[model samples]
Target: MNQDFQEAVRDTPGGTAEGQVAVVTGGANGLGEVIVRRLHSGGCRVAVADLDGHAATALAEELDGTRATARGYAADVSIRAALEQLLADVLADFHGVHILVNNAARTQAKPLLEITPDELDAVMAVNFNGMFNACQIFGAYLAEHGYGRIVNMASLAGQNGGTATGGHYASSKGAIISATKVFARELAPRGVTVNAVSPGPQDSPMVRSIVGEENLESYRRTIPVGRLGNPAFIAEMVALLASPDAASVTGACWDANGGLYMR
Candidate 1:
């Protein structure tokens, strides 16, 4: 609920990678916002980019306070050119990017048979296409730098194919899992690690939007942990993956599903 609580629970005490610069897409809200805040608590300069320009600017200002290490940008990740410009702006502000969190995604809760062609396209454009663009563009930057960390946000639906997620959303996340592997394999040689975090129904607006408040009680009963996932917990995993200590961990999909879908 508060930044202080999130910061206190962090496993990395003095911060994961102090002085490092990170770029987080969809960083204005939900898990993305928590991730941005967690990273900042770890002493990393961050850039928060989101389609909601107002919210993004507000978040940036909240973090900026006295120091201006964190800045927000209004950009749609689905657009290739816009993402390119976002990378440029972040670079200009931070001077360099050492970590990238591909957290921007869109999803809906339509039945498999009810999903329209346009619906599939729209979800893919953000969930898959947007992630791809960021990886390729920022992946290039990380490669050139010969050192960087990339953490892609994935979901339980990607592995299970249902879990209340529509077919389009599930498929897009599955593709992201595969893409993470591809990026890891290609970028590892260049000293960049690409990993993904697949979390089960989180206690975030995104999950509430899809699952609805009325059904949350039933959903909780199904989770082995007896509760929905926490955004901060997910953020902690991202921080660990982004940290220098995780340099050897790549091409991996870390699960944070509360034993709901264990491998």
Candidate 2:
């Protein structure tokens, strides 16, 4: 880590996130982008880690020269070696990590019978195993530091056996929910809180790609709220879960589904 950067992070208003560092995977676009924006606005220096480094860098530049500094790193969350390097780089740049948002995921919807082993494995690797890897690596750092926040992005599909995303995607998200509980249990005593945000269908690029433009209107009508959720709405939920106000919240799954799934 650069000594100057470390000093900057240490001197951050609140220490943990006032200017402290946060890592957001899949932060180039869609819900990830919204989350990054919200965290930046909250005065956190953010590392936008994504497979698409170009887009991530662009977003960083957009937020540069502000109270919150942003950096872009290209990484494939599914690969352990890549994640190891990503974490090391983040620590080197910021001196220490305070927050981690495991938001990288892929939703490949297909009938259960039609899904191949490779397909299932790929989804599991990114959505579930990727989160596991992050928690293991960063969770250790958080425990050492004695404070941290982790918000895993899950989906309504995980809870309801999936209305939109079927098979592999749903299973992977279910695993995310389970992992959140396990992580919270293990890290709570260290002042690290782990939680999950399971969002319903949102107006995101992924949603548009999955639902299609022709069916978007019909899908919106099906939700009780009469509209697909916006990225900002989901971002608000994430912000709250990641904030000190939610200190008592851990090992919990929050449903931001516009009443689509009530539990």
Candidate 3:
């Protein structure tokens, strides 16, 4: 297996997987990392899957040196074969998987008109295709197992054409929202739930880079809440949706955009 698919091995600060075995895509950095940590703290055995194998392993080791409850697997969500291998590796290491968080994504700051075809394809490959395939592959397995949770990382941009992010990113997320509903309906009867978390301008590196330090305060004022969203809180939303308690909720997009957009 490639290093990307290698299962390396985290400790639960507070959390069972059912035993709660969770595989978090793009779990090596940013919001995805936070979700990984949050789930681990909530007693879930976590598989920190990311493109950066070394970083994933480091985080996994930091969470659990013993590698009993936490581990890292490297994967490129855009590649079907890589994802398939990831599933096999995770199952081999964790025995059973109960949660799947589709957080892997790509974005560019290029303007819509200037956006090259290649750029759009690259973003969609990771943000949409990767997540969709994971749902199909993992959803089937979870349904077969008779229980599972799937929380996808959506964005307010998908609903409102995006702010600072690229056009391709927004389109990918919009597709994600639609697919979340479809998958939820398809898997609901099998004891599996599929949902999405859409966040607005968050206090994350990505947002910071997009908005820039000089314009951040001005941008915050445009938000109804007058502040950027918190990444940790967004992670909490993912955690809540992934919990067994949230079995009743599916095909829903929970928003945390600080009133940036409202239904």
Candidate 4:
């Protein structure tokens, strides 16, 4: 970690997340990386889990002795076996899991007519099934321990039929939102709060790939905020939901879309 960044994190106050153990999937890059850093600065023990083991481990090393406790794990969120192992490892290493951020997702930009079966399935597997696997495995741990906070990453695309990635991506995210509601209801009795964060077009790696340069300017113009969303904004929202302050908030979809999709 940069000494300057570490110092800044240590000095910051107001939203202290001390003693919380959080698992952020897809934490190796882009928005996920930003979220991991923010959670760390807020004084939480963070586990940066991603499919890329090297990246995950590298991030962990970077924050090894910073203000917040940190570690990394490589696991495929889409696979049940891998997710099971990940939950076990996280529980064993951290002693308990307090928060789970289901941020791992994939998008397809193909038109409906040209969408292939395999491609569609791949998107669903990563966006929807991956969330289920994490929720089921991690939720179990939280339930056993009697407390947890779960934040599922949905998208404005899911709410508005997808502006860039097409129907397949939208469908998967919609499923995530529905799943969030279901999990919140089922887990509430166990002292677990489950919610979804639906962000509009952001300048993340995932959005950049789906929203090409030619259309990026036009898309920004269409948003009521007249600018692209920031990863920090989304990270802050996730941190809030994961905090004990949001204990009463459950089964709600927090929209961070910059007025792109109002409901």
Candidate 5:
């Protein structure tokens, strides 16, 4: 190991992402919000895209009052045209793009059998269809540029069939895990890496609501780590995968489930 490089990382964490531009979907709140903050703090120019434009702008301005390093956009990824427009908008604003983070998703707690067709379609539109379109649109731009990084958000539910989040949500995530590999293999030759970060029971609002505040202790005890995962740490993992040093990590699904589900 290079002790000199280690010291430099300690002194300036953002050096790895310096000069890189990243677009994060669903970046207005929850896990997406934390990931945006982490990347921005690491010196990456971040474009915060979400359905909620107001919140996204607030976060961007909060990070950089002059809008030099960050900006927010309102986008619905389910629409292919919208994703294409998002690509154009980002390129116009940033002059170039390098990293994309797919963190936008919808979670429902309905029972497996009770999940209706309409409900499943709604979830898939946002989680699966949206992600698939992004991979195609952005992946193309990245391939044309000959370099890019895509980090998709997966869930432990996808691997274990889930206990609280609905079956549709699990299925969508499982699809994402598979898509990551497909995109990874195709983009590898083009100098682009597509990967995923699968998280389980986190200290996030979604998990809190699913497990209930009163039963939080019991939920913590069930996990092997005896605690919920930290969103900041998850963001760090996303940032790592987005960094230049992670070129060799394509097609990998880095798990952060606190030992809840392991390979």
Candidate 6:
């Protein structure tokens, strides 16, 4: 294998994304935050988009102290117009985008039967509609550019029907997994690779909020790794998937579920 491919597999701390431009949704906190940091550290110019503008700006300021490698924007991905504006702003600042990481999502742990229609709709708006908007907008941009990376954030719940999440959340993620393949096939011809990363229950703030400490520990005991996944673990996978070295890796859903949902 080539050294670059090996480096991508190992996810080393280097400029794998050197000079590239990337946009990450829900990048203000949790797994998205870690992904933004990792890509920036890999020498990529990153645009951090989130609903919480202040938090996003704070993170961007913290990471890009020099304000040269990263910028943050407040955006609601559920709104197609907002996403379009975000795309325009990112292009204006970064000139062009080479990577798009769809990491924004909402998680609820209610029982399937108890999940109300409103709850399902709200979750779908963010988890599914938001992702679709980004893919459609950025996916087109990448296709036009003739080369890019698109990493959609999925979950183990989608594949295994939610060990710790609800039906609404799981179903949305399942849709994302399916959409990844469709986009992958279509964009491949344009030199754009689309893929998804399905992480097991991680110790992210979202997961913690959904699954309390007691339940989290209970779930951890069931995993073969015996511990909840860390945000960095998921971030590493996004880093690899966003890197130029990952050009040949696409149209697949990567598993980082600590053996909880082995395929």
Give the candidate number with the greatest lDDT: 5
Clashing pairs in 4: none
Candidate 1 local lDDT, 1-263, one digit each (tens): 13432332244543366677888999999888999999998888888999997898899889986546788899899899999999899878777788899999887778888999999889999999999999999999878867889999998899988737788989999999999999999999988999999998888777787778999899899899899988899999999999878979999999999897888
Worst 10 residues of 1 by lDDT: 1-10
Candidate 4 local lDDT, 202-231, one digit each (tens): 887667666677888887888898988998
- Highest TM-score among the candidates is held by which one? 5
- In candidate 5, position 71 carries an lDDT of 96
C-alpha lDDT of all candidate models, in order: 0.87, 0.85, 0.88, 0.84, 0.89, 0.86
lDDT measured at residue 229 in model 6 versus the true structure, 0 to 100: 87
Clashing pairs in 1: none
Per-residue lDDT over 1-263 for candidate 5, one digit per residue giving the tens place of the 0 to 100 score: 13322332333443386667899999999999999999998888899999998999999999999998999999998788988998899989887788999999988889999999999999999999999999999999888877789999999988888848999999999999999999999999987899999998889878888888999999899999899999999999999998878879999999999998989
The per-prediction tally of clashing pairs is: 0, 1, 11, 0, 0, 0
Model 1 vs truth, CA RMSD:
5.8
TM-score of 4: 0.90
Better of 1 and 3 by TM-score: 3
Q: What is the TM-score of each predicted model, taking all chains together?
A: 0.91, 0.90, 0.93, 0.90, 0.94, 0.91
Model 2, 32-120: lDDT tens digits are 99999998888888999998989988999889945237888998999988999999998787667778999999877678888899988
List the candidate 5 regions with Cα displacement exceeding 4 Å.
Answer: 1-15
User: Residue 226 deviation, candidate 1, in Å?
Assistant: 1.6
Q: Candidate 6's residue-wise lDDT over 22-57, tens digit each?
A: 899999988898999988987888899999988988
Residue pairs with colliding backbones in model 5 are none
Question: Which one wins by TM-score: 3 or 4?
Answer: 3
- Candidate with the larger lDDT of 3 and 5: 5
